[model samples]
Target: MKNIIYFFAAALSMLTVKAQDFQGVATYESKTSMEDMKKFSGNNKEITPEMQKMIEERLKPMFEKTFTLTFDRTASTYEEEEKLGAPGDQMAQGFKMMGSLFGGGGKHYKNVKAKTMLQEKDIFGKEFLVSDSLPSIKWVMGSESKKIGNYTCYKATAVVPVDKSNMMNYRPKKGAEEELKKKSEDEMKKTNFMDMVEMPTERTITAWYTPEIPVNQGPANYWGLPGLILEVSDDKTVLLCSKVVLNPKEKSEIKAPKKGEKVTQAEFAEIMAKKMQEMQEMGGGPGSGRRRFGG
Candidate 1:
């Protein structure tokens, strides 16, 4: 009994010491399907080959992106990898407006020890610092395993509650436009734009983590795993870690974003909901049965 206790104590001490100095940089490639993108256009007419090609060209930059995650034991920052021109610059003009609807413009910081999340976002030329509690994920560990590079990863799954502002969950309800057409103009004017779109209250997430990394960290808002998450996917998007450099010579400070107006995640959602409604009322945007943010 004494030997077992002493061994555990020694191991715990080693882990603590190692965690103090451990940091890593991981690069992830994110990709989403464009098949559903046409739904956002609200154009029932069949698309010409030229129009289809043009649309794909414009959306290519938005659908495919690279991000880097810098992390320590308890905290991390994830941001899109810097490239030529600003983000969304190459996207179609309409998509650039919808870009603000998604929350990927700036650094996303998460601290596991503090159970807090802070994200910096640029919305319609204004900056916002969104603060909130970390997402509570009850991951169901699966026995399935796979090899991602040299690391052996185990699968885990969870159904996570989606924030009301998460544009990824927005899908135009079926026949919403036809139903709207039947309403009087006054009724339509008074209609709540949110009712036209469907936002699933929760979404299923599948994550593959590697125990070899020994850190509860991942890309984007995902965390709370037994190890570092290497690959994660929801219904439409997949984030796969393409490269990981453990204990690199250059370590960055994992600090939470302090700039921009402070607001809770719920408050941010409300602000966006109102903004979207306003756009709808103008006979444009999502309310016109067009240009909705989608996964």
Candidate 2:
């Protein structure tokens, strides 16, 4: 009898949330910590604490971003707010620009009903509309619960591939890749892949969701939860929902980005790989590379 009562309570909760239209917007504040980079690259070259501080300040705009997630029952669009002007030295400024090109800040659209996604990407000024199937996450539900703002939240976790969260942005030559594999275990005995290489094959993502607001929507490429995800943390970053407005006076224009040349995720990866290889050949990355993006 107790179990039956609990089941009906859950059913009632779900039905209540579903009865009310959940068309609104959630604003998220994303912060990227550079402490990891500082520790790794601190001794890579001659650098001082003040210098590190300068780099951190320069990366402020990119590290601290505001993302708006406009969502409804099964369709949602997430995009970063326009950035303000940045202040830094020439080198810092250059690094910031490089981050914009190689790293994040893109418009992402997810449709749970259709199981599809349309993402807009910018690689070195060239735009690409990446259209593909939504990557599924095998989320393991947890018994933990917490309160986020006015909503009571529960926990969930997932072991996701690194690429599902972000791109590598590094592409070695065909021969170089083979050469790396050819290295004997004895030869690499002294070298540490953890401290030296970017091993982003897998990552564990932890998310906090609010069952009170039962909507399968979240920021970025995350969704399909029984409720809206209010906070998510991974290896490199944490995105928290700072504000949520339900049934806003003005209806949001939730539309997938239609600009840029259409390409699949794999297709975009190949293009980026080719471009990186060429750039490295000319004079880039750790070694060197060529530039000229399809020029």
Candidate 3:
């Protein structure tokens, strides 16, 4: 009986050591579907087949992207990977010509143990770091399971609240603000263009996580899970982990990004909203000299 007890204690210690040695880097492929964008163009009369092809081709780099998520026991950081442009292709050449016009995304850091999150974003030429509480998602665990890569993952579903005003930025300048002050709120919504109707909806999120990892971290702002999220998707975008290296030889530095204009999420949204409104007033939309910033 003493020998049996000693053997069981030794096995438990080994298991704890193995769990402690777990640090992983996951490579994810992200894709955003463009089928829904077609619905927005009500009788696109000016859209020729040639124009459509060019638009579709340009959308590739935006929709199809690769990112790396470095995670440990309690936190994770997600950032997009830079890629080399292809050579000797007309479509690629076209994209390269407009390279400086787009691509300014943010870095996301989530610390589940601390219940904190930090987002570093770039607006035009300015950088801002928005810190907020970890998103509170009420996830309903599901019995369905599937194998993604080497991990057996279970499904979880949630309905996330969408704030439309927070998603768009349209802050008006002094002159526009003064002129716009005379208009009522109803008139503001009627004349205000740019399709801000996506607000006030419940977006569904479906996630698949594996308990084998036992870390409540995932790419971007996703968290509050019992294990590592292998795949997650909403209607427009999907993040799928293509490769995960557990106990990596080199562990990445996990720290919060603190170099930017400090602002809360709500404050940042207000700033963006005012900026967007001003830009639109100055004839800024669909090739109006104002470049579109990537998220």
- Give the Å shift of residue 229 in candidate 2: 0.7
Give me the candidate number with maximum lDDT: 1
lDDT of 3 by residue, 123-225 (tens): 6556778888887999999999998986778999998865333332122233543444455656654443354223445688999998766678888778888
Question: Between the candidate structures 1 and 2, which one is better when assessed by TM-score?
Answer: 1
Ranked candidates (TM-score, high to low): 1, 2, 3
Scored by lDDT, model 3 comes in at 0.69
Worst 10 residues of 2 by lDDT: 164-173
Candidate with better lDDT, 1 vs 2: 1
Off by over 4 Å in 2: 1-21, 86-96, 99-102, 164-195, 286-292
On TM-score, the stronger of 1 and 3 is: 1
Clashes of each: 0, 11, 13
How many residue-pair clashes does candidate 2 contain? 11
Question: How high is the CA lDDT of each candidate model?
Answer: 0.77, 0.71, 0.69
Give per-model TM-scores.
0.80, 0.78, 0.76
Q: Which candidate number would show the highest TM-score if scored against the true structure?
A: 1
In order of lDDT, best first, we have: 1, 2, 3
